[model samples]
Target chain A: MMVSQRPSEVSTSAHERVYRTLRSRIMYGEIAPGQALTLRGIGREFEVSMTPARESVRRLVAEGALFLSSSGRVSTPELSNERIEELAALRALIEVELASRALPRAHMALIDRLQGINMTVAEMISKRDAVGYIRANLEFHRALYLRAQAPAMLAMAETVWLQMGPTMRALYGRLRRTEPPRNHKLIIAALKAGDEPGLRLAVRSDVTQGLRMLAG
Target chain B: MMVSQRPSEVSTSAHERVYRTLRSRIMYGEIAPGQALTLRGIGREFEVSMTPARESVRRLVAEGALFLSSSGRVSTPELSNERIEELAALRALIEVELASRALPRAHMALIDRLQGINMTVAEMISKRDAVGYIRANLEFHRALYLRAQAPAMLAMAETVWLQMGPTMRALYGRLRRTEPPRNHKLIIAALKAGDEPGLRLAVRSDVTQGLRMLAG
Candidate 1:
């Protein structure tokens, strides 16, 4: 999720800094699932004490972005198939509402911006840059949801994205697609036409189509 | 807001136990908004050390159920009107989908159980017991959403509840009503008729109406 702050290595508290850095990496699918992590390793990598590393790990665990064992071992989550399906359904239900809400506010400038982002997504696909593709795809949706003028709803939707991150990386890695995101085109067209229902359908279709590949 | 576990007073680690208890109380609206909390006070209340108390507070803060000031003081959240509206919209979006998914699985016995819970909600309202009413009303929603077999969706809906708990307590306390939950009856009727659209509308109305009272 956005977590409301950029990671500043300069002045924030150690744990807060670690929390933001780890949160962003997880939300953007930089981490792989089931990868074991230790407080010592995190402390070493971030050049912080173990206390802050442990606290940051605890914070991420609270956000459902990471898993912690009873013995205090921590790892990126390996979501079950059932959990994956539910998150996909949630994305469909919420993003459709967000896109519909944004429809009245979407102007040509916004549409042009989305098209630019879509091009970056296409570039990522061609370059086989998984993280870049994930970042650009989220940027496209974030740009849309921002117009909804609903921060709470946007934050919740982004949390679902955070939870889906590692698994999405796996899903995308397994299914290589040559085509650009056709559903994004539909989203842009619906916006241009100010079609609320069409926008909802396009958003839902885009979310579900990508997810169904994992399910199948 | 169930957090899928009961608050255990024994055997578990002190922090885990404290987290579960505080989570349940906050989720159930047992705490009031703007209620200032200190780590020292929590340690005393739960008869635990400051370490566990601090850890639990950190977890709740991470979950958005509690707010922490820059000075590190903690308090139950007092939501703004706009935030409340967004959460209500979220509820309508997610719960309607959950109810629709549950419809085919909602047997007569399930419907009967909901009727029983609704009766308890009515009783609590009549008794002018705000917390009891909130708990029963949530139980009513929970019992129905449980049948959806969508754990992740249910968990998301419950987090909205957790975030709203204090505000909901404050809202219901101000608006005393003589009638039972009328929209709930419509929900039951729609469920019985197997009308998906009716069910969605009923659920949406039920979710929106209670929240609108606070909005007004």
Candidate 2:
């Protein structure tokens, strides 16, 4: 890869590159809460300068994906029990609407894609791969939301996911359910039947079920 | 004021000062959509260096409070019609939950405070003060969400407000409605009567009404 060729292939600014990488990691439960990070560390890992690293960190902090302590240490957020419950409620609220909006636009092809992702999710669960399971689970939701044509709403929902990443890893690790996601099937069925109320309920149930154990 | 004395009272980092000032302006509808800003201009206005201004602008851009063009110009976002509809759906979904959560904790004092804010909203409408009306309307919602004890969810709701600030001004300016926010009155009544379902409906209606007008 020549240096000139590399620049054209990757035109994004350094900080944006860093931000996207970190965002995905946090969104998919790859990072644990209280995991401290530093600009120098990130710069080294990503082969970028300290300035870009700091900018990326600042963006993440603003989005609640990362937390900054009084002493200025950066880490993934360890949400309080109340905060977790609140985020869960938000997921239920926002994602259900997203599903409903997508319902009208949802086609057989979209449903097929979601069903395929559900299968991947089931495989991840069987393997006890927490991160893979979380990734696939969100993919299912994201695929549905992409059809909703509501970027602003979808962005807000993704922020909730980013904030919940660390906590979700912990939750999924502790839950011993052998069954794959029950409500996902309901969600798919509701979508197929054009059942709006049923779709909303399925989404609400799926969104809340993962966090309910932590609340208990 | 002596330069030395000035730097101490405003001891916040330059970027933070810039971020907070711009955040309030955007959140309160002081800035309109498509209002272009430059890093140099922001630094000059705030009496800071370009670095801080750039940092602040980056944070805002990440939060969807501002937009960044391919040419690197910054401006308040002018949301698309589809985006506005999505945001409206988001508000209805999240706010209904917030109102429901707050219902258990919403006592007489909170209800009284909300009523007071409602009065201000009415006065603003009569005066045709678009900014004042928006501020008071948000205050009413914020007061209720505060009681919900769900900071994370409330924060997400407020972000939606911040993003909608400019459009809200446009929406209010176009509508010649002299009637006080009807749904707000219902919200107050729902709170007074301790009707959970009624509270949810009222809040949903109030959140979605203005956006629906534009969406139509």
Which candidate's lDDT is highest? 2
Index of the highest-DockQ prediction: 2
How well does chain B match by TM-score in each candidate?
0.92, 0.94
Who wins the TM-score comparison? 2
Please list the residue runs of candidate 2 whose C-alpha ends up more than 4 Å from where it truly belongs after superposition.
A1-10, B1-6
TM-score of chain B of 2: 0.94
The residue-by-residue lDDT of candidate 2 on B51-149, one tens digit each, is 789889989988889999997899999988878877787788788988998998988999899999999999999999988988999999999999988
Model 2, residue A168: distance off in Å is: 1.1
Question: Candidate 1: global Cα-lDDT?
Answer: 0.88
Q: Candidate 1's residue-wise lDDT over B98-121, tens digit each?
A: 999999999999999999999999
Tens-digit lDDT track of model 2 for A17-51: 89999999998889988899999999999887788
